[model samples]
Target: MLPRSGDVLHVTRAASVQFLRPITFRVIRVLDWPTYDGWLWLDGYELNASGDAVSRRSIFVQREGLHQVQTAPQHRPHTVRTARRPVARTPVRVG
Candidate 1:
């Protein structure tokens, strides 16, 4: 889902991935810079256990990595999925 200002997202912290945990956050702004290999920056505040504000910070995440916790069907642990980059090739000379 496309994220916008005031949208809440469920982000998986790098340190907590080993434990499969996620933290809730509210999006304050979306950066306008071009995407770098599918990663972008998002500025927002981290929500506490009671859904309260903690502190504001900028987070880097992939476009597809950010999940809409507000409209998600279900909440669960984050699963890591890796895709292989396709090899680029020019026209091959036939014998």
Candidate 2:
């Protein structure tokens, strides 16, 4: 984590976090140790309810301290059209 601070941290990871308790103080503070890292925290009901986020590789992970250059759009069109829809009659979990 140290290398990314000033190229001090070599690796950065984005992971899910759950906080069980509520702090009564109106103001809040979050401190990090020597590691050069960041957070992607979700609080309770707001966490998994959104279909946009799932259990696996759910979030877009990117490297910090690096700028992302926009890429040109691809010239090819999508192989499938908008009318395509998957059959929804599949079985659900029995559990």
Candidate 3:
């Protein structure tokens, strides 16, 4: 699900995944920016359920075109599937 216009995102300090780019994850505030396709440079709000904020991160993300994956996340289980393709090809000369 996408974040609401005024929703808040909580970036816990215990987070293991490093989101180097921007994304439209749940629990994040939406802002306005001039960009095409992907999620552009927008402001992020950090807050805890107890009315306290943990940390705020600057973000820019691609909505659909780009592929997003997680490197690591504590206490969470994930399943991924990969494709197998030939790495090299050798030509044979017929006698």
Query: Which is the leading candidate under TM-score?
Result: 1
Tens digits of per-residue lDDT for model 3, 48-86: 445454666555544443232322234456778698886
Candidate 2 C-alpha lDDT tens digits along 43-77: 11111323222222112212342131222234577
Q: Could you tell me which residue pairs clash in candidate 3?
A: 9-27, 22-60, 22-61, 38-62, 39-61
Q: What's the distance in Å from true for residue 95, model 3?
A: 99
lDDT score of residue 81 within candidate 3: 62
User: What C-alpha lDDT do the candidate models reach, one value each?
Assistant: 0.74, 0.24, 0.44
TM-score of every prediction relative to native: 0.60, 0.15, 0.31
Clashing pairs in 1: none
Off by over 4 Å in 1: 13-21, 71-95
Candidate 3 or 1, higher TM-score: 1
Off by over 4 Å in 3: 6-28, 46-52, 65-95
**Best by the lDDT measure:** 1
Candidate 3 lDDT score relative to the true structure? 0.44
